[model samples]
Target: MERGKGSPGKAPRVRAILAGGLVLGVGAAITLAAWNDSDFAQGTFTAGSFNLQGSTNGTTFTENPVGSPATLGFTTNPANLSPGDVVTAPFAVRLDGASTYDATVTLSTEASTGSLAGLTYELTQSEDFGCAETVTETLVTAGQTLGSTPASVTFDLAQGAGTDPGAPVNLCFRVTAGAVVQAQTGSTTWEFAAQSQ
Candidate 1:
């Protein structure tokens, strides 16, 4: 018997127990590190387009932008002037086929030169292009002085359905000369401003 020496079989059993403990520790560490997964999301954004167009004959529509305006074809010759004379014109407005938004249109008058004094005008929305004596929807009240901007008069327009141009809004402009209206060359311009809604 040797002093301070354990049995060989007992030493082998102790080493086996230590190896088993290390294996268990490694397994517990792997179990603590759990599996993980993730999810992601995204989005896209864009802006819509809008445009407005006008027509004088209600058939040939075009962009009547500022600086160059469409000429209204008056039923009576506007060149000739007489006291107590009245003339009428038909103008149409609508959203272009490419427009994507509806709009509210406001009517206003620009400054005039010569003979515009003592002349009064009225604006009305009509069913047809013909601006007859009969009126349907009065936009600007009668007796609005020429070259003076009237109070805010607004109307609505819808965007076209499926790429076709929106339905036309027919407008009638009636101008009358006062008894004392001057006899000279004059010019007046009106604006139809549209705001998208």
Candidate 2:
């Protein structure tokens, strides 16, 4: 019958209380968890594009073929010309695509065999029937001789803010055979390329 030792009759109740306390303590130490979830959304992106077009006549433009370059054949090929003869042809360039861009126009001599190399040429941009040297007016300078080493004249193309295919830039080529040009059969090729910036 000591005070520190529980009587035999109360021992079972005390033991039961101690066991319950131990279980409650262990439960408190265990980490509690709840349902967790996450959700996600997907998005897509597309790219823009740039393209150029060329034409001999302002009304008709030819876009570059998907896999090939566009070609602008002279509306009228200059042939059988005598000395002192001057010929002028009209050509045009345009921009076509969803995006707007600064464009560069370049005139490059391809290749030639004959008197065509001896002829001199000048290019002009005309507005309202008045024409100005494209080289002087824009970035390009002077003309090219077909028979000489390959040459290129490049200039920035002017475009309007709202032009869909972009307004056509009217170009005029004045080809002259100097009075002293010798009589010889010759042919030449020239390429005009429009690039986006």
**Top model number, TM-score:** 1
| lDDT of model number 2 | 0.60
- Cα error, residue 65 of model 1, in Å, equals 0.9
Would you list the C-alpha lDDT of every candidate in the order shown?
0.84, 0.60
Model 1: lowest-lDDT 10 consecutive positions: 1-10
In candidate 1, which residue pairs clash? none
**Which residue pairs in candidate 2 have backbone atoms (N, alpha carbon, C) closer than 3 angstroms, thus clashing?**
none
State how far residue 175 of model 2 sits from its true place (Å).
Answer: 1.1
Q: Tens digit of lDDT per residue, candidate 1, span 1-197?
A: 55446576488899999999999999999988887788999898888777888898879889987689888888888788687889989999999988889999988875466767667888899877768736678998889887776688999999999899888899988888776444567888888888999
What's the TM-score of each model vs. the native? Answer: 0.82, 0.62
Candidate 2 Cα deviation (angstroms), residue 92: 0.2
Residue 148 accuracy (lDDT) in model 2:
43
The local lDDT score (0 to 100) that residue 2 gets in candidate 2 is 81
